[model samples]
Target: MRSTVSGYSALSKAHKFSAAGLVTVAGAAALTFALVPQAQAADVQSAGVKTVSLSAQEFGVTQDGELAKAADDAAGQAQVKAKAAVKAEVKAKADAADRERASRSEARKPMKPAAKPAAKPAPAKPAAKAAAAPVKKAYADNLDGWISESLDILRAKGIPASYDGIKRNIMRESTGNPQAINDWDVNAVNGVPSKGLLQIIDPTFKAYHVEGTSWNIYDPVANITASCNYAADKYGSMDNVNSAY
Candidate 1:
């Protein structure tokens, strides 16, 4: 009975030691889990801060106020250049129209019937050239005379309008009246009424006014010159236009 009791006591001691060992192992495992998470969390937070700082620096450099203003100024300069280019294109077109009119004037010269079919063709060309030279005519007050005078001026200025074209449009629009006005039309309602022989609106007259013509819309020469200039801008030349345009 004594030996059996002794054996039982030893067995109890062994079991207690085993349980203690297991508890130590469990505590170590718990500590490792807790410490590892803290270290990982610190690293993650540091990386997050660095990312945020870099983003802020990038925004500061790219979207700063001074840089933004510089970008806007460049855009404005580009716009100005574009507008100037458009103006240059318009000027080039007008110049081409003038050259075309001069060519046509040359072509319209009357030939001297080949100098009675006996003279050289070269002399005939010279005769045609002399005929093509503008003849100085006394300006008259009548519509016919006025149109003839206006054609002379157009020829001098290299404008491409013809007497027939101008006269036809004037007769249709204002019946040869220099002081004509459309007081009931859309232009009139807008306070920019069509005035003068060619039915020119006020804005059109102002924008296309010629250098030597009178400022008054009722002035015959002024109205015709301005109308021709406007036509040149709109349709290449007055000779190219017909009808209600």
Candidate 2:
């Protein structure tokens, strides 16, 4: 009986020691699990922070690209506006030149051609006289007619002259003769004789002949008109002409 009691006591002690060891191991495992979760959370937080930083970098890159694109668009717009302005200026100049050329051409053209008579036998003398009276007379035919025509042109071309003024000069210069010439004057001795109703020298005629009239200095209308131009240049207007000059 003593030997049996001793063996039982030994077995009881061994059981108690084994139970304590199991409790200690369970506590260590629980502590290890909790620490692992905390480490994982820390890793997740670090990764989130890195993701946010990368997102910020991407946003900055996008903003830079947008700014560059906006700058490019602005430059392109400016180029287009500049080109348009240049094109408009060129067109305006071309249009102005065309209008000037047209005006000059109009000035060089004849007013109208003389109409042809009808292809018919001769009519009675009274009827013929009546028909001839109705026919439009040319303004360049006589001195009175030439002066009147020149006054009309001067008004249109912005050249200032008057009927009384032109008539007075014409009567004094050449007695209203379209073919008058100054053969014995100082100008004649100089080989630059003054001719025509206005007594204009060849050099003077070539210099001051009206633009829309005949280029011939002896032409009645051309003579009167050219004289007016010269008179205006020398003395503001033909009305001021009262001397040999």
Candidate 3:
């Protein structure tokens, strides 16, 4: 029986040791699993805390994008400003040109004055008249005898020679003879036709012949009256009576 107890204790101890060893192994495996999880968490935290650094290529690309955006915005603003400035300048030039044109037009305009009438000249005055001359004595005395016979015949004719100068011219022409003839005539042969008293020829007799004288060339009253009428007609107012007959 003692041998049997000793074998049972020895088996019991062996089994207990074996169970303790199994529990230790399982605890060690569990502890390793937990430590692995903790190590992985610490590695993740360390990676998150590490500082990141960029390469030249990555930094240039980032700066280039920002610069391109800035250039685009500046270009847009510049275009707006250029358009506004161009419009303002064009408007200003047009206004200035219009003002200049208006100024030139005003300067070219014509000025006007009041209308005036033309004047007329005054008229000039007239000049004065001249005086008359006197008669002489020598010419009156030489003209006396012919004056009486011209008056006698003119009295019979009822038409007297009014002036003394006219009668003197008649006596000088025919000596108061009714049948007196000029010597240019002959009696019978080679006789040129002779004139009557006062030496009146065929032309004078025909020009002054009276209707009541009966064609007689020697009729004293008819001859004398005709001679007086001829003298008055030849001279104006009998003033040049001697030269007229």
Candidate 4:
């Protein structure tokens, strides 16, 4: 019985060593599985972060392009408006110039005229001349009667009366009519009464006397005698018959 008990004890010791080796192998396999899975997860996370940054850069570039196009459109509209305004101003200036030229042309046109003058005239002329004298009828016929009467009167007065002297006195006194008077006779008021064929005044007859008769201015014979004596004493001759006593 003792031998059997020792042999069973040795078998028990061998079974314990085999169980320790199996446990060490199981622990090593579990550690290896856990470390490998952690490494693979870190690599996947880095790749995701790089992809997000690329998307944000592309969005910024698109927004800048849209703003540039809007600015260019606004500049083009401003240029078109300026060109239209310049054209309108030029057209207005041309119209004003045309109106001024028309006014000047109207102001240039023309007018009319007036009248004339007159003339003058001329002058005038002169006049003419006259004629001579003549004789008488009684002196040609009764000259001898007158001569004889005058000589008788002279002889009575103691004076000489020639035939020529007597004839001249008769012619002067009455043109031989013994009844003559001046056509233009006027009566005397201031000096003396006058009378007869010879128109002898009172003063002249009183101053000279005739022989055998009172002085009578109205008697042709008395007047003739007195005038003959006065003429002989004052003037020497009776030849100028028209102008003598």
Q: Who wins the lDDT comparison? A: 2
User: Which 10 consecutive residues of model 3 have the lowest summed lDDT?
Assistant: 27-36
Report, for every candidate in turn, its global Cα lDDT versus the true structure.
0.72, 0.74, 0.52, 0.51
Tens-place lDDT digits, model 2, residues 1-245 = 11123223121333334434433543322122111233344453344345444555565677789999999999999999999999999999999999999999999998887888877987756644444455544664667778888888888788888999898988999898889999999999999999998899999888988788899888888888888888889999999989898
Comparing 2 and 3 on TM-score, the stronger one: 2
Per-prediction CA RMSD (Å): 46.2, 34.8, 23.9, 31.9
Better of 2 and 4 by TM-score: 2
Better of 1 and 3 by lDDT: 1
Q: Which stretches of candidate 3 lie over 4 Å from their true place?
A: 1-160, 163-166, 185-194, 237-239
**Candidate 1 accuracy as TM-score:** 0.43
The digit string of per-residue lDDT tens for model 4 on 198-223 reads: 45555666665576544656556666
How do the candidates rank by lDDT, highest first? 2, 1, 3, 4
Instruction: List the candidates' TM-scores in order.
Output: 0.43, 0.43, 0.29, 0.32
Off by over 4 Å in 4: 1-146, 183-199, 237-245
| Candidate 3, 84-191: lDDT as tens digits | 999999999999999999999999989666676666656655555454453421222233433444455556556536655545554665665656777654531345
The CA lDDT at 190 in model 2 is: 100
| Shift in Å, residue 150, candidate 2 | 0.8
Tens-place lDDT digits, model 1, residues 91-165: 999999999999999899986565455655564444444456656568889788877777777778888888888
How accurate locally is residue 188 in candidate 3, as Cα lDDT from 0 to 100? 19
